[model samples]
Target: MNPTDKNAITESVSCPAVFIAAPASGQGKTTITAALARLLRNQGKVVRVFKTGPDYLDPQVLAQASGQPVDQLDLWMAGETYCRRRLFEAARSADVILVEGAMGIFDGEPSSADLAARFGLPMLIVMDVKGMAQTAAALVSGIANFRDDVSVVGLLANACASARHRELIELALPKDVPLLAALPRDSSLALPERHLGLVQASEVQEDLELRFEAGAKALASEALAEALMRLPPVVFEAPFEDPFVELPSMAGITVGVARDPAFSFVYQANLDLLQQMGAELCYFSPIADSCLPECDALWLPGGYPELYASSLAGNRSMKAALLGFFAADKPILAECGGLLYCLETLTDYNDQTHEMLGLLPGEGAMRGRRGCQGMQTADLPEGPVRAHAHHRSISQGTPEPITHGRRQRHPAPGEPIYRARRLTASYLHLFFPNNPTAVARLFSPEPQLQTCDQSDSRSLSDAVE
Candidate 1:
């Protein structure tokens, strides 16, 4: 039976939704979305927030602002069915749903505009009009008229120099496209960013709260509030039963998850799916913790391991525990930074080398430019899985490749998945909802050995050295 069609219970719900987008990156989509969410929540409305693409950082800020867990909505990686299911579920309890777009409005293959058009949601384009006035309207007009399916309902002028600046831009905007709000140039309202993008919200919680409060105040004008309240309701039919209900259970399994500053790039939905499948998850820090929690399998997610390489390398007990875990032939799944942690050494962007777990025979070097990126699909024995690969570190070794990935933008080979014994290490971060069975089987108790011809399973000691 089709996974998305099994035991489907149909129901309809109304969710007033809008996609907060921008003309390009750094145009304040995330900031505006957070401000709007805060304003709506202040008005006593339950706001469900979502981020468009495969980002982990922006969602953190959105979640904090809405006081709710933010989910990602992507057309390719997350799939249309999954996106519909999430929208249906959010509509059940949320009075409004705000989706923060990725990059520019029409950036990638599955851009924010595509998502809005797919779901019949209007676009609230936020543009940074720092230098020009009438030219800003040309950009907004181009985005609004670029596609027939999607419509730009409103515009938010960000980083305006003065009241005169805001007035000029408002006058220049097309009559059809309304100017909802003009946020004055306030560096205090800007969120701190790092190489990967905005720094994680946890790192600067107090500062982020202040920025959100200021943003809300700037966006609390009567026009902005009225425009938000007047958004058309999104109506969709979906199965009443949780979509994850059909997934096969993994009873009696405990999955140890690495969760810390060094390994925090995990999707919340991934953990939720694990719980829904009956797997007990225990989180331990490799940077601060000395040992791994007892579990049947281990999952090391992607994060800023490069930034804390020395600390993770200094954690002798944690390194030993990881080596022992690999020796036991227990299942393990590592992505990006996790893959780096399993290597013998990690060279940061500054060219300093630090010892790593050495579970895999390789040394990962952080590069100034992105090593690999874009949507990736891996063909595994279990099944095909779709994910996104965004990293800046290159691993140097000849580990046997278990699955080869294909990139979406270019029809070229992508990241290679390395399998040694029960370990599945790769640069691609798998979206669990895409193929729950394949992911669950990765942690199944009864491990399946690879075919003799394709077998690259090596002894733990041999793999490390």
Candidate 2:
């Protein structure tokens, strides 16, 4: 059958979609999902994978495995319309859609089960059966039966010890819920991790390719990868109207985006939205670049800045360029690790203090294992934009915040939104598509912002020297 035309989409489209979920976190969901995607991709199929929540790392891995651009589908952060539209667009061309669930199946407020039910996608529960046998079947059975709205179609047993282990799980499962596949316990299939989560895919691309090939080869002999091709396609309807169609135009605006090992936690959707609104994105590296690109504004997304503190601090010319940008009152939006880079000082895990951009009067340091992560709305002076905070670092002695992020559930505020001159820095990473107008306002230059106190402006000038 011919694929649907991109420009001529009707009310709805259909494609086989699977929600790859787990009983809980660390069930090797990323490994299984990436491997499954790779398996199908190797068979000359178009696989579009999406991470279910505000995740950066998993999408990176999945995107590389599937050889397709991956997106994040969240009911709250991106909204139901965005999710539906994304699915519809994918269905137009993709052979199959795979959404890797976050944390657990029934984990968050709008849980993986909630999203699965909302879209009527079949669920494939992936469980690591290394230490257990029949109990795996019990857990899968319970999860399958727990919600009437969600349809549990099959199960993939990860890290099964032997044929005997696979037989034990298969025999215990219900007749309707068959064992799709049993991936062996192979150390070669394991992805590396850091303090945050899985290390960035770029850092381990060559090894990842080998792992993907190995994983695909592993799943090729199983029923799970083949079953994906035969699953019934779910109908995805397009939104009646594009809510952001009338977003403020960012014509003539060139935003310098920091894209490097230290600041790579950017959502593909955010970049897409910026271009859609007529803004040109110029990518530069804080860790490598000696000067800023000639642009109207700047955006620093989150990543492992703590890991590359020395490199960022050592780039004196780049630091001077940043100070000049700040002194000129150019707009800059920094999130999470970006927030850290703008601080006066940053202490690494080794307790080594490095001088930062000093765009804000603060010091950032790692908090060991403790971290803050949750969905919130950043109450920016431009407008409220939906965002989330996930970081293991903290800032001290920062200027007073202009506003605070409103928590998704609690009445109290979440992360502090600090505004230093034209810089809107925070630990919260804003989802641009959630409020394109607000995001446009953020990147657009404001003349009133030039009225920053004389002392602060002088300090920025002094730092430039």
Candidate 3:
């Protein structure tokens, strides 16, 4: 049989997996998921955790709790084959696989429910049950019975106060769906947050460690820890061939990636794709390093630029280095916070202004609680790459956009894509694996333009599906 064929006899790997989801956002999903991961890790079990959408902060926290590298799993952004292959590979070595969902269970286009149902992974709904008891059972029952395709194995009632609260929820639950555990309302279990989502793990690792231990002890009680261990192993099939095996090579091209507290939003998968395509990667810090790494191209991903605006402005040598690189016409990709850093001025949340790199004649200002966020396609001159926009800041007085982002659902144009010399700056974060060819060209010295397309994985998707 052809190894790449749909009828190919592929080997299967089995491992226990659970999709940790919630009724809606702000329901303590990350906290409970991290607790469960830490609880299992304390028992010496290798736990592999996957986040269900485009996120940077939660994955950092989850990775620390699980003691494993976390990967994002999205059906629309990453494709079915990519998600499947990641699961299969993790299953081979992982004792338990935990996928933390984004937003509500069935919120997005390819929602958490869609991924869970497709893979036959049962869901453990985490909801805040402080306000009601029997109502909790009602909501969970509706979610479980609403979709026949999805499987609901149990419910993890969060923020339960007294024994009476647990008893009311337990008694109202259907026999088929069990109440796994009732976690107490403890402030210590909560993860700190800011304008974005959770605080970066590196900033408060010690505090997170204390919270993780507290959460683990809570979940370890009432046989909840024992119940999670009993989840049946799910079978996963391996991909026939690696997707990047045939990607265009960028040999001898060294790309500099900004990686520090100020610009740490670079995707692991993006770096992986670059290396797989024969490109060399070097890391440099814009906040700490005075000079750019000796490389052919530069990538500055999004981060909390507003928080470090003063420090970034104080680093005069770094600004000069960046200007020199821009003057040389080297390719520089800046997204969100990176775009802010490139502007002439940036206003922080406190309204404090600081001078920036001035590579672009624009100013960025932080807007409290008001921002744009959605999936879009960067209609780049090189080619189209699937991307997303999530930022609280807005830009002013920049050059006219060379092109606009194609919104995922809306008919209107999304964020503006600005091109100054060889630099490509935008508020949208590009998912490189979606279109390796486009990304390769973006970072190359002379990009050869082509007809715009979503990705180079259509044939792979067809074969896998």
Q: Number of the top candidate by TM-score?
A: 3
Q: Candidate 2's residue-wise lDDT over 1-465, tens digit each?
A: 112344333577888889999999999999989998999999899999999999999999999999999999998888776787788889989999999999889999999999999999999999998889999999999999999999999999998999999999999999888999888889999898888999899999999999999998888888577787688889987654532235557899999999999999999988887886789999999999999999999999999999999999999999999999999999999999999999999999999999999999999999897899999988666667788999998899998898899999999889999988788999999988876656777888873322232222111001100
- Candidate 1: list runs displaced more than 4 Å: 1-10, 239-245, 449-465
Please give the RMSD to the true structure for each candidate, in Å: 5.9, 6.8, 2.4
Model 2 C-alpha lDDT versus the unseen true structure: 0.87
Q: Which candidate order results from sorting by TM-score in descending order?
A: 3, 2, 1
Q: Where does candidate 3 stray beyond 4 Å?
A: 1-9, 240-245, 451-465
- Which 10-residue window in model 2 sums to the lowest lDDT? 456-465
**Collision pairs in model 1:** none
lDDT of each: 0.83, 0.87, 0.88
As a TM-score, model 3 comes out at: 0.96
Instruction: Please report how far candidate 3 places residue 258 from its true position, in Å.
Output: 0.7
Note the clash tally of each candidate: 0, 0, 0
Compared with the true structure, what per-residue lDDT tens digits does model 3 show for residues 232-281?
A: 87888766663234566789899999999999887778888899778999
